[model samples]
Target chain A: MSTLAFLGEFGEAIQFIFEGETTREGTQVGGSQFLELTVEHIKVSVVAMVVACALAIPLGLWLGHIRRGSFLAISLSNVGRAVPSLALIAFFVAYLGVGFTNVTLALVLLAIPPILTNAYVGVTQVHRETVDAARGMGMTEARIALRVELPLALPLIFGGIKTSAVNVIATATIAPLAGVTTLGDAIINVSGYGDVGRLAAAISVAALAVMTELTLGAAQRAVTPRGIRLESGRPSRRRTLSTRIGRTASP
Target chain B: MVASAVAALTAPLAQVQLRDRSGGDAGCVADDGLCPGWIADNFDRYVDPLVQHVYLVLASVAIGFAISFALALVAHRHRWMIAPIVQVTGILYTLPSIAVFFLLLPLTGRGSLTAIVALVAYSLLIIFRNITTGLDNVPEEARDAGRGMGLTDRQLLWRVELPLALPEIMAGLRIATTTTVGLATLAFFAGAGGLGGQIFADINFKSNVVVAGGLAVLLAAVLDAAILLAQRAITPWTRARAA
Candidate 1:
């Protein structure tokens, strides 16, 4: 098919989401279906992210402050890569029975690694002397973490959030399989939505995923301190030789 | 459950029949518990999907590597191409594979080809970043010495830069390969017939899911290990240095 034909179909699909479409069985699949499912998708994704942040950020920041668990923090994402999301969901369904809570919990586990890893890296990347100076000024450990380290690590932590958000959103596309009617029903439930509805729903979820990524990206930029933003262009001598030697386009 | 167990235990070993995944023991299947005997009997069902899964991973990673290698080299030489290329591939990488699988279905049709295309798009950013980082990390002195010896840019890249970049390049390949393995489980959505199809076929079946899903994880581990081993063998210098 031509690109024009595809676009026309895509446009029609989008309109169908707003106006609703009826299946051959004469069921009224209304426009609200799209909004309803997308909202659920966001709801679950948001809940998962909030829980992941609550669990991972503090643990990661504490580990980094104490200078422990380096191996675990760094290797988590790598190990995460080997495990398939589908399997994780299926495993949950098989063992625990399927529901919103089960799927959400699985997603929470899936989303944790990137956030935890990034939080650890972000905090540990802070200068030791900076933390020392905070200590020397009579700040408590908790105060130093909140006042000195958290601000510096804000951009990277937000980066992890963006990543986890995108991942959780993507994984949520399959949440329908476990009995939650998210936007994925458009893709998975052909009988209910038909071909055009599937395409339309896919487009909507893709847009949502991209929008989340961009919004978080902007948040990351906003959180970055001006001094760090300016200094990011300059090579750091403090890093190990392996990291410092790279002569590439600036970050 | 007890009756089903008695039936399973009383059945003569030689008389075992190939029951459907859900056909094995009534209580066992009802409970969705792992029926090992049924799995061994039905193991053949997974072979084809597992092979399809392997093909999806290999073809996508190979194609992704070729494209990324060319782009990385171009970006290395021009310097200006890096940002745009990274941005574009990063978007491709960020888009969920399930979405990409369907998004391409209209344009590319529903088949392994569509699945491979989506999978390849994902590997581009990962492999490209690593390849470029590897290229860039080659010591300045090595390049200067090659230049002083009257070596041209092409010769220097092939003989020194690429070889030196092997470690990072291999790391990228390992990551891309493993990630593709995980993602290919979803290629069943594109009608690519992978282990994912098998798992999804009877998702609630404990035995079916365990075997099928376990195989996918095993495939990722095997490919990752193969790449790590290949990297070590090719870059004998790295091993020697460590020793």
Candidate 2:
């Protein structure tokens, strides 16, 4: 198809997104619903991310502080990667009934493993010398973890959050399946949105996901303290070798 | 308890399957329960979709690896290129494949091509980062040894660095494979006939969803195990090392 034909009624599609349209089938779509769905999508993702962070971060930090359950944190991450988002959502919809809570619960499951694993890994990787010095300074365990280890581990912890944030937002596209019509309403109910409107919705979702990733990435950088920022020059071989050894030690 | 839960899950599906016109055993098929007989009899129906799914995963990963490997090699030689390449691929990675399907539809049109392109984009960041990190982590002593033997830069990279990097590279491939399998389930949106298409065709039917989704999950596990085994075979040194 020529560019012209391919973009057939593209202007109308944009209009349909901002100002609702009655399709040939006479179904109302786009317009204000787009804003509603977008808000809902963000709300669900934010809720899931908060819960995931609350549940995973402390556990990860405590476990990492104790330097135990390395196997649990790491393996949970690996198993989490193998589970497909669609199946998880479908299972929840099938068994638990569908709505904001069920979908948010499923997303929290999706979001947890990475944050948990990263938090654990990050704290464990904090320098032994640093931890010892803090202890030597008569710092309590909780104080040391919060003031020293937490700040040092913030970058990696944020790295995990960024990963989960993107995953959760992308997964939110299918929230419509659970009777929560996010932007996926346009994509799923194609007859209602029509082909052009579907394309518009897809573009919007893509934009949303990319924007989330970029924003979180910036936030991650901002939260990282200057002392821990990686220097421009590559580290010497000895430093890298130590990290390599650390990798082998972990599951 | 497990059986009861499965039964509960399947109950909703019975109504969905009731709408389906064709069935060999109307009673079992009608309820859309976990009808093993229906799946067993209709096993042939899954064959084509499974093949297509495999093709989608393999092709996307292969092409992704080829691109990433080449870029990693070039980026290794010019370290400055790494960050920009990563940023671009990272954006690509973050974009969900479902949205990608529709985004590419107007340009690439609907087919395996559209699905593969999105899948390939998603794989690039994972494989590229792994390869670059792997090369970076090759021990200084290994390079010195190669140089002492009068090996050129190319030979040292090929014989010393790349060999040492194999474990990490293969690990990236395994992750990429599993991820691609999960993502490819949505390829049906791009008109690529993967098991995802099968699942989405009658998503409410428990037996249908279970069989199709199970095959996908099974595929990921099998591929992951195969890669792990391959890693062991190729890097016997890793096996010899104490855990």
Off by over 4 Å in 1: A235-251, B1-19, B22-24
Residues B127-163, model 2: lDDT tens digits: 8888887888888888999999999999998999999
Error of 2 at B219 (Å): 0.8
Ten-residue stretch with the least lDDT total in model 2 chain A: A242-251
Kindly list the per-residue Cα lDDT of model 1 for residues A1-251, writing each as its tens digit.
Answer: 46677687678878878888777787766497688888899999999899999999998899888889988887787778788999999999988888889989999999998888878887898899999999999999999988898888887788788888998999999999899989998777665776677777778888988999899989898998887777775664222322421211111
Chain A of candidate 2 scores what in TM-score?
0.89
What's the lDDT of the predicted structure labeled candidate 1?
A: 0.83
**DockQ (C-alpha) of model 1?**
0.32
Score each candidate by Cα lDDT. Answer: 0.83, 0.82
iRMSD, per candidate, in listed order: 9.9, 8.6
Best by TM-score: 1
DockQ list for all candidates: 0.32, 0.27
